[model samples]
Target chain A: MNRTQLFEQIKKKSSYLCVGLDTDVDKIPTHLRSAADPVFEFNKQIIDATIDLCVAYKPNIAFYEALGPKGWESLQKTLEYIPKDVFTIADAKRGDIGNTSALYAKAFFEHMSFDSITVAPYMGEDSVKPFLKFKNKWVILLAHTSNPGADDFQLLQSTGSGKKLYEEVILKSQQWATPDKLMYVVGATQAEKIGGIRVLAPDHFFLVPGIGAQGGDLAQVSKFGMNKQCGLLVNSARNIIYASSDKDFATAAKSEATKVRNEMENLLNSLL
Target chain B: MNRTQLFEQIKKKSSYLCVGLDTDVDKIPTHLRSAADPVFEFNKQIIDATIDLCVAYKPNIAFYEALGPKGWESLQKTLEYIPKDVFTIADAKRGDIGNTSALYAKAFFEHMSFDSITVAPYMGEDSVKPFLKFKNKWVILLAHTSNPGADDFQLLQSTGSGKKLYEEVILKSQQWATPDKLMYVVGATQAEKIGGIRVLAPDHFFLVPGIGAQGGDLAQVSKFGMNKQCGLLVNSARNIIYASSDKDFATAAKSEATKVRNEMENLLNSLL
Candidate 1:
């Protein structure tokens, strides 16, 4: 999906929610275990429940990867099941050298047909540039992550640039891609810093994780992070998906997603 | 495999050579295309021919992932085909949040049964710590990479510690894992810097790539990077694997591996 189409989906839904499919086999409802492929079955119902409530689906690749070959089959099925209009983000934090990164681009973009894939910026511009070559695809580069370990290297100040490492990443990466092709993963936990990052890359969308399960405030994220285009796809996974492990799991997931979407709707109204 | 087991393999084989199984379907011999699983067939032959010449096999994950589920099956088969005593390195530069990283560790260590997996250290301590939890599995962290893009962030001086970002990675990561469990990727192209890195972590092995295809010098890597335990696994992929795309491909691969192993043998002798 292009930036304009993604914005259109957001406006149509009245929510910029990106439901994260971090579906673990052990965490799913036990009743589904008898099914041939429980992981895909669980994801299918979750998508059915929440499809209209969100504009994007971010499937954390690690969950599928841990399951091995069968897991990848589940992933392929899940990706094909998601409506083409809704943006699909392969939350695979993949980055490597130029040639290898090209293969990764082929894996997610060409082969699997995800609209975007999250990339780690540690390998720098050449690693990121490969993904940009594909038209209408997005590269959501990691900036200030939500994890406690984000403080490790991301926050360090670079002597040459005088900006913090992530700030430098944002600044340097702008030279490689425009807002239409590039986005940043600014954790909702770092809500205050979003305003500053907005100033740095004012037009680029921010894929905001850490909203619900990670203790990030949705109101703060909307207040500080939103651009005119509704440039925030606030993600909530466990709080919504695992809301109920009973037979009513899908219905419970819908209720949770509705609650969050309603809050997002109110936030959008307040903006006007 | 543990450190002692790995060193024993190096001594027993008289080489610290690591053959990179970066198997691309397009690059394999055309005759093999008729096989049901050409990539696996090519890899099996490569393993059969050169298993004794090298101590480690580093399979770059992106290549297989590009082919989807069947590719993963090939990877699994190739992993199972390798001799248990030889070390297996999943050159999958994967790292994420604590919970997610744990799943990655499980994917490579538990599901795939790799001895060690390469991890990008941009996410910090918590991201890396999960991979260390497995009993004898290893985390080979990226230090100074061989790519031209490595110059971007890794070489920059950090204002906080007055050290290069890669240097800080080396120092901080030491607190996470001992030499027994941790290794660093010090590219053979950065041969001059390997001496300094060796001083930083004298006992930890260095998985050095960029020997043949990338123009890294073998003599320099052996002289500066090798410790008393021959703590270096020099990797050469394209130069060895694609030595000939003909009927003699496997034999040609074996010959290239032999030539490199002979050079490594001479280096090992000089060290004694």
Candidate 2:
């Protein structure tokens, strides 16, 4: 989806929420195991329950990949099942050299038809530029990740630019892509830094993870991270999807999503 | 395979050559397209031809992932077909948060059973630590890549440590893994910088890509990068695998691999 289309969805939904489909087979309701494809069945219900409440659905590729070929099938089904108006993200942290990265872009953007795929910026420009070649497809590069390991190399100060590695990633990447095709994955755990990041790329969107179960405060992220366009897709996975283990799991998930959406509604109203 | 086993294999073969099975369906000989599971058939022939000449096989995951579920099936079959003595590498540059990374490790290490998997170090310690938890498996981190874009963030000098961004990746990553389990990708194109990288990571093995097709000089990489253990696996992909487009494609691939192996043999003898 293009920036305008995504912004339209957010405005219509009143929530820039992206429900992460990090669906683990072991964690799904026990009764679904008998189904031919439990993972897809679980995701179908989740999408049905929460599609109206959120503007995007992010299926973390690792969760599906762990299950092997069948997992990929589940992921494809989930992608096909989601409403076209809502955006889809292949939360696969993929990046390589130019030619190899082109195949990845083809894999996620062409074959699977995800509107965006999260890419690791470690390999630098050529690794990321392939994804930007596709119109309306987004490249959400990893910035200050929420994980404990974000401190490893991303926070280091570059002597040449005198900018933190993540800052440099944002700054340098702008040369390759505009706000229309690029976004940053800024962890909600680093909410305080969101204001600073906003100053760096004020127009670009941020795919904010680490909320809910990861303990990131939504209010803080919404306040500091949102731009004039409400440039944030706050992802909440486990807390919303696995809210109940009973037959009413989908309903329970909808209730959790509704609560989050209600809060996002208030936040959007405050912006207006 | 463990470090000792890998070194022993290098000693036995008298070569540190890694055949990258970047088997693209479109690139394979026209005759094979008629066969069922053509990508696997192409890889099987390539592996069968080069198995004696090379000690390792590195399958760039993008080639397989691009074909969807069938591509993954081909990868699994190819992994199963490789000799147990030969080290297998999933050239899947994947990394995420702690819990998510564990799943990727499980997908490649447990389900696919590769000897090693290349990981991107942008997220830091926790993103890489899960792969280390698996016994006898290796984590080859991207240091200085071969692509032109490597100059973007990797070569930038870090103010805090007075090290280049790639150097800081090597230095900081040492705290999370030992030389026995951790290796770094020092591209053959960066042969001039190999000496300084060897000083920082003297014992860790280097998975060197960018040979013939990418204009990386094998002799330069060998002279500057080799250590006491002959710690390098120089990879040659397109130049070797797509050496010919006829029915003699397998033989052509074998001939190309043999030439690279012969050069490596001389280099190893010189070191001894």
Candidate 3:
């Protein structure tokens, strides 16, 4: 579950895609609703069908959280089903005071058996450091988000230093943890600037979401963002998970995953 | 509840207090452990005992998320148990892509009835605007945090702007939502600089969370951070909820809440 193991898996699979499990109940095909736990069943199929084509599985916490208790049960079962060789991320953007954060780290890393959890950097170092205390776990900090309103503050020139707030976060957070346990979320839609970001934190992995449905170019991201280790975890959620709404939804998901993985294979090959 | 309604309750109670329901299962009283759902039972008692003394109840999402399915059930029950007159906040620091954020807004405001939610401003406008779309809801943005390592980025001056990152977040987030639908998380521990922050965000309410265990001076925060409308919701989580673990835990919680409210009343009186 450590960074080295994660990187080795990425190489062995010839893929860096992290399938995002942002499953919404109403959005899933109607046929699966009758299952004991529809969400878990959906995730289980996706994992079984495409585990070899991905290096990571990211389950956004909000989706499970929305369903309340049943959703949580699905999340726990889904986590248990994911192969240990593949990295698991509880895409829960949690950040709080130190003590509270320590408990959060324990929840995802120990209690739930996740390899990592997404953390919001807005709360500062103490909030993030608690998660960093766990060995072999990664803390994915939000950088330039893909949303249209990302310009409101993240891109605003800091009144004192004149750098964008995200750039400031990238520079400062480097002191809290190394590339091994720290990663940055550089939205794939922000591909143009990935070159600049790589310059700042050249060795760290970047959890690049926003590909597929978000309109981010895969080749562009690979060209500008890739490091010696192919430091990019390109995530595709809607395009893969909901590729087909029929009873063959799992099979459809695997095909979509393979397509993306094939494209990534080409990108990784070019890297060498 | 709208901002005006929250203000009225604050004045009526003579308390600008927002007790935090960071209900950690590990820390719940041993007696409650035998209950079917100890976390919910513990939260229900806390809400019943302190509902009259405080204007709002803010629940940190991590504690609920830690317990998985059962924990989420406790959170839902606790949210429903809170009185209609009091404001409810899902203290989830959520900010994501615009589409994903819109779903989060629906989950918290429409699906569930939380009146407000804390948000990380790192993603800028689109990530925050989704939360503001609902009527009579508030998006409390993270500004200068109460954590020790906030200096990592929030305190750093922009490369040329001469303004700190937190100051920029306060100023720019104004464009995304009006003060009526938005608030800022200005840490109480940053009392010395509250005067400066008040100047930048004079109209927006601030959810200050470092008063008790963090050693922030309530008086200093009131003097420097308060506005004409008494726009400060000072929060004390651990110091109040875990005030005493004895059988009189609820009574001890009420006493601690009363002490903060009394101090706040004095501050309000002086401000007027």
Candidate 4:
């Protein structure tokens, strides 16, 4: 919920890996199809198999949303399945008008019980601030993303700082909330720049996606990105979710998740 | 769900209003609380009552997501309740890794059947291009937001053209998708600047929020932003939803919606 609590969980679990529940219906094991809600069934299994090994479960909302009502039902159930000690992220990338964002904060935090939700900061403070109003919830603002088009706007220089637009977003947004509640979304693909990001907001967490399927080196990410509390949630979605796709799909997912968690454990151990 | 079909619905309804379903749990009618899922119940009622009055229903995903599993359920039901002829917008504002975005596209278009979804373009083309790949669906990119902090990044001038960051985004993103499938969110509060926006994106539909509660002037927005097919969806969310707190909330909402529709009709007439 808060930074220290999140840090303690990472230490307790001996891992900083956040299993991304980016569950695609077609991608789920065929065995799950007969379950009441296949997506949730799959997620429940994954959480059941891997909860002790990881400190977080980041469910990318799109996967569940794609199934229509059933998909949403699955998403809700999956959120419920995740343990309270593990940080949960909607990974919704939501930000909007102030009042609307306030409602969104309530949706993810109050309703779903996610400890955090990823936010797009393009709309500025008003769009992001409403989410921060929730006690202990984190707002992971988009800083330097890993995508190719990240060059288009985020890398552009701003008036206040010769630094890129994302840098400006990071520096400027810090005024709105404290590091304990405010985090940054630094693409794991941009692993080389994690040090620069840490310099910007030294205390906040970074929801680093683009790790496995997206080709982000975990070594570099952990090396340059981790803070004193191992402040990086390295999310691996596809590589783990589709690790086997056989009868042992959930077991295979656990193995894949374990591999990442093991590497993260190594990194955390090295940090001391 | 394509541009022509969307345009036809606008003409048939004689209104360019897109009622925003930024429904908050605390804001919902007490009667709906008795239902199994109050948010969905509220959305079902709103859709049933306002079906013919507006051409589109933009459910701000945050509100539904805030309720967690139920919030997503409400979003699904709201999408289902909307008439097929009326455009449905998943105002989720999602943008992320290409693989993740592909899933988001599937969730909104293939699963939920939304005609369009809002996205944040700060991550650049790769983050946005995946959404554009869906046929007949639109990506309503955030260009100039209405919030006060919008000045922080969107209004900043890029180096070469002296164009504002949003202006540069408008010009460059136009190359990714045709105006038919791409729309920019130009805030109604920036009505005076719409003329400038038109210079870059003359024909793309503008999902204009902030008209009612955000103090965006409709007249100025239409005068500067309108294109031949009345290429503007003026959203009025809170001013309509919370129009009345009493038992007559639906009736009151209809009256408020009707007033905006009448004004939109007048705007259309003037444009024609």
lDDT of 2 by residue, A1-272 (tens): 78989989999989989999999998889999999999999999999999899999999999999988999999999999988899999999998999999999999999999999999998889999999999789999998899988987888998877899999999999999999999999999968899999999999999999999989999999999988899999999999999998899999999999999999999999765
Off by over 4 Å in 4: B8-14, B28-53, B68-78, B247-254
Encode model 4's per-residue lDDT on B47-96: one tens digit a residue. Answer: 77677789988988766665655566667777777778988888888887
Please list all clashing residue pairs in model 4, or write none if there are none. A66-B107, A106-B66, A107-B65, A107-B66, A107-B67, A108-B66, A112-B68, B64-B71
| Local lDDT at B18 for model 4 | 90
**What is the per-residue lDDT of model 4 for residues A1-272, given as tens digits with 9 covering 90 to 100?**
78888888888888888888888778888878998777888888888888988888888876666666566677777887777888888888887877778887877787667888888888888889988888888888888877777788887776545677888899989999988888888988877789998988888888888898878999999889988878788888888878988889878888988888888788889765
Q: Write the per-residue lDDT of candidate 1 for residues A22-44, one digit (tens) a residue.
A: 99999889999999999999999
lDDT of each: 0.93, 0.93, 0.86, 0.83
| TM-score, model 1 to reference | 0.99
Score chain A of model 4 by TM-score against the reference chain A. Answer: 0.97
Looking at model 1, give its docking quality level: high
Predictions' DockQ, in order: 0.82, 0.90, 0.60, 0.63
B140: Cα error in model 3, Å: 1.1
lDDT of 3: 0.86
